[model samples]
Target: MVGLVLEDWASPSRATASGGEYGVLMYCAKIASRAGHTQRIFVAEFRPDSDTQFVSVGIKHVRFWTLAGRALLSKKGVLSSIEEARMQTMLSVAFGANNLTFTGTISGDVCVWKEHVLVRIVAKAHTGPVFTMYTTLRDGLIVTGGKERPSKEGGALKLWDQELKRCRAFRLETGQVIDCVRSVCRGKGKILVGTRNAEIIEVGEKNAACNILVNGHMDGPIWGVGAHPTRDVFLSAAEDGTVRLWDIPEKKMLNKVNLGHPARTVSYSPEGDMVAIGMKNGEFIILLVTSLKIWGKKRDRRSAIHDIRFSPDSRYLAVGSSENAVDFYDLTLGPALNRINCCRDVPSFVMQMDFSADSCFVQLSTGAYKRLVYEVPSGKQVTEQAVIDRITWATWTSVLGDEVVGIWSRNADKADVTCACVSHSGLNIVTGDDFGMVKLFDFPCPEKFAKHKRFLGHSAHLTNIRFTSGDRYVISAGGDDRSLFVWRCIHAPH
Candidate 1:
């Protein structure tokens, strides 16, 4: 086994109660392989009297070193880059089964990563921040839309081929901010674009000709658009507190349902039989597709509903809110809309969520650090010490306080889990942290300090982490780090 050392130095002005300067430092050591172990060490210096903390790191075989905190690689791990300006924020991400990942950034660049490494950077792909992105049915084709800048025509739609090369650009004459875009038609040759001006623009990918299909929302901006699975119809949710269903072939509005609240997002069930709408007032509603009759509706009252998605099987609807909670509703429960589970008190605003492919679990991401996973139908939290802590409380209370006071375990470390996801099999989970560490934990982590594997390459807070379809690898990105890292996983016994 190789040994790792850590050192800390404190300034003389920051003396402790004992009249001496004090500091805290931690070190971890792991076997590199079966032989020729590699040693990695890091030293952090803290001064209570100063506003800054300094860290230095070194790694043996990789020959990695860092001075101060600005160097690319530190003793922690190798820093990956796309040879472009540091990304401001990761606005959108898309994955391909071919091991290709595409990310859009606030810097107006679209980066493509293969096997978790940055392979291509489409620099300045837009005039302003890339707000939305979509991947076509064809493997390599991607569509990106951005906000308008002061001097340049913004809200333009651009298409790129597989090599991160721009193939076509379509400029929207409406000058409205494009909020969302989707591929329409069976061949994926046409695009559907939604704008804040309450317009749904349908344009051809080859000709780039814009045709206004609907401009009916008179009240407010349109936030979401959903295409029907089998029909030439689509649904649009607007801040006007209504959902409009339009017939593409007829070039007219077929129906409009007043949801009574500003709708932020709408999603059609996989079978196209139901539509779920999320409102700005935290009201979630479900309606039958054909009749446009309300099937069920519920209000959370805590915060606005930001997103809603249906499980792959259309068995459940997951609602995410700004209040840091995710509610799972079993669609088969009818008028009761029977909420099977509620994951509440997440560290920050719930920004995104997705159900496992098997519909066994739901994964959620927050605005801050940390991700959470919970079991479907059961509502049991499978991440952190939530479930186990409850059990421990019950067991400990059953015994007399004096009998177990001396034998209790130490407190678990506090972590602001920002974003998390469970594997398809529901066997493993990966989470990103505010400190830029991506950790792998066993499902339903029974203990606060459960056995976990850590991957440390990012030097900034991690914004997103996800497992590949087969659960063979994990892809992580840090907005501050401006890079993506992929790690291979060694299966553990369930």
Candidate 2:
């Protein structure tokens, strides 16, 4: 059991700044000099033995350093910095057993990367900051939605061919900057796109038409959306403190739940029998998918929950928030798995989080100046380093087909990257940044794990990353630059 410690990151820093508010403010002003300064990544990890540690990445090339005062491996390069204004968001998807597809925002352009090569495969896909993008399970294509330049006109939604070289090969215009895009199962050959203005559009190969203009959320905008994995049911959480379940085939609202707090994130159980929601009040609510019955609720209202995810088995729910900890609870049983704080090492204000398929571990992306990782079943810290930027979990794979951890990084102490995503195999992770470049990271299998791979590519601030159902490809959505990039997994090490 892990203890939970919640704190506000923006609180008065006077007490910690050695002086008063003015002193702290002055300190921040001085450090602002380093705000845009560039930095590169250096890697150090514990071996399977946990005794012999290795360090790599140096000034000229990757080389090796010491564990107990002995050199192992170390590598280095002068990675250029993407301008602050171009960084937007990053998203990722798993395409193969060992590859990730990446998309990120860079000042109105979207770019895609294959691995961590610090180069772009597809560039300049959108005209504004790409806020979100997603991929359909049926095919390898990607759909992206983002804000357009001038800010006056809303963004548009466009479709892309993942195999292409430059941005989206064939883009279907939605005529508006869509905050989010959800692909709902539409029977024969169609998908649905939900927009910022609450409009649902039906898109297919031949025709794309406006389906429904949802007149919900009078007080605020829609922030999150998800579809039931098994049924035609969809869930949407809004700033209005409500979660609505819509029956896609029926085109009707099934159940509208007033969670009594601003809903920031929502997810369906893998079985599609329940919906898990994270609220602004720092609580989580579970609703029966079919009956709309409230089965359980967990309230901690001290910090805002930024994301929530259910274990693949639907037995546990993981909550990520502005607080420095991640809380877990057994949904099949009772009493949430006592919240786990990453001690002082874990940063605060997480932006997003994901659980492996087996729910054995959790990867959290933080706004707290660093990222953290935790073992799920036991709620223990697995890594000793603080991530200086955003990260995402793609998947889990093992020799027994058990739990394997997959992750990707963005804003890696260098650029102002925003979002990111991963696949299911735990073999590949993709990232994007402000430079409008996408990069890929591959995890090689240890003799103990059965497989492994290295990562490459990308040159911008990545905003978003998402993996497909089969975990064979990744779709990336960029921010600052309106662009959408897709990368297929070139290899799957099974």
| Tens-place lDDT digits, model 2, residues 170-232 | 233545334444322233555555555444556664555444434345345344555455454
**TM-scores for candidates 1 onward, in order:** 0.36, 0.41
Off by over 4 Å in 1: 1-216, 230-232, 246-253, 383-494
Clashes of 2: 115
RMSD of 2: 22.1
Give the number of the best model, judged by TM-score: 2
Mind sharing the TM-score for model 2?
0.41
lDDT of each: 0.56, 0.48
Model 1 Cα lDDT, one tens digit per residue, 1-494: 11111111110011111111124446886422221124432222222222332222222221222234433333322226645434244555544446555666666777665544556777788766665666653555777777544334334577767776677767665444443342222135788775554456788767767776655564644555555655656677776787877554454667778777788777778788989998998888889887888889888655788678888777788888888778888777776876777786678776666566577766555666355667775767786555423321100101011222221124513334444555545666666666756666555454545555555555656555555445554545454543334454555354
